[model samples]
Target: MLSITGAVANSNGQKVFKTLKNEELHCSEAEMKAHLANLYEQQKGKCAITGIAMHLHGQDDCDSDMLVSPDRIDSYGHYSIGNVQFVCRFVNFWKMAQDNNRFAELLDRVVANRVADTV
Candidate 1:
């Protein structure tokens, strides 16, 4: 049986375990952390979709929108190394709540609205 106490002891470990449980995916804590680190390097501490600065627990001001969470680029994909990326918690939740094409369209609309306001 999985140990909840140990899983919740570390923030990253907790996230890793939760993802495994919620998604019915399987991966080691070390592997998940490594994947998260890789995505952090690739994204340079920004949301994968929004490109906004991330709010890490110890590194930045905490915000609901900036909470980092693992995302599967292909929703049906396994929680493997290359398939996972880190995204803002809110953005990930929003994306999962809609169809991918619709989500993309809405994101484009939001970006366009922001750009229009700047003009």
Candidate 2:
């Protein structure tokens, strides 16, 4: 048993190598880019509550970790467009460890009663 720490390649090269060569799975830059693009489209390029186009997918702090992850594929969220939403960056990450549909109805709407004002 051993503990790996510090500058990765410098302080724990052997351990890092072992972990890197592990038979587990992982993601590549190309795949990440594609997934982010899909997420951007699914979230509608707008805020779920504001409905404005000020939302973005990847960045630091401002729009960091802003992805709509569906927890249930057969229940609350079916991993489809309907189950997805454009949420705040903080909420996105916080909900990452939880379900999303519970707060899915946070969308804004115009006063439908005034629809006849122009019609």
Candidate 3:
């Protein structure tokens, strides 16, 4: 015999679940929602590294780089409540590209590059 169950999801919850699954993360939909709410309270939508406000898909203009996303405090760590927080997608990708601790130096270089591009 087989048993089937149904889960009800609002659009936001569905979005969270999809993101987690796509990232191959271990968080449940409920956990992801709770963590995101807490992060919004604590960070007020600012990227932890760049201090710029994140743009969420439904709420703001959806720039892939500026979109809000979960970032693990430790690169290899699991996505537990204390280990994860929301950040700008750009910062998350930039941090993942190299070492997390070098964000300051990388930000400096990024600024210089922007300045050079305009010259």
Candidate 4:
């Protein structure tokens, strides 16, 4: 989990440095790791988007959907302290570059439709 945070922070730092010429806008790896750990506890180890239980990377026999990933709450924003959340890996992929609230609404609709169809 710590390593994942480090990788994400490093990657985002590079992007922010290159684009805005200000790496300080992004959270440091240590800060991100601590934040994620707090979020994990607060979220009850569930994905922020799907409410599904999440597994740390390399946990035994977990699928991609169960993996925890750091997602930017605002797609256009920097990876700062208040801007990031822990979500399922699949949800993060599905939400790429989309407005976060819009994507959540779309996901809700999809689940609603699926439930309706089942009924």
Best by TM-score: 4
Comparing 2 with 3 on TM-score, the higher-scoring candidate is: 3
Question: Candidate 2, which segments miss by more than 4 Å at Cα?
Answer: 1-25, 47-86, 93-96, 105-119
- Evaluated at residue 19, the lDDT of candidate 4 is 57
Clashing pairs in 4: none
lDDT (10s digit) by residue, model 3, range 21-112? 23335778798788779888799889877788889787646788899878887766667777776789978877873445677687889899
**Lowest lDDT 10-residue stretch of candidate 1:** 13-22
TM-score of the candidate numbered 4?
0.72
Write model 4 residue lDDT over 1-119, tens digit each, in one string: 99999887778544353454223448679988898789889999898877889988778878977788888787777889898888889889899878877898999999899999999
TM-score of 2: 0.32
TM-score of each: 0.64, 0.32, 0.61, 0.72
User: Which parts of model 4 are misplaced by more than 4 Å?
Assistant: 1-25
Evaluate residue 89 in candidate 4 and report its C-alpha lDDT on the 0 to 100 scale. Answer: 92
lDDT of 1 by residue, 34-90 (tens): 777877998998877777877877764689778888788777767877767777888
Instruction: State the TM-score for model 3.
Output: 0.61
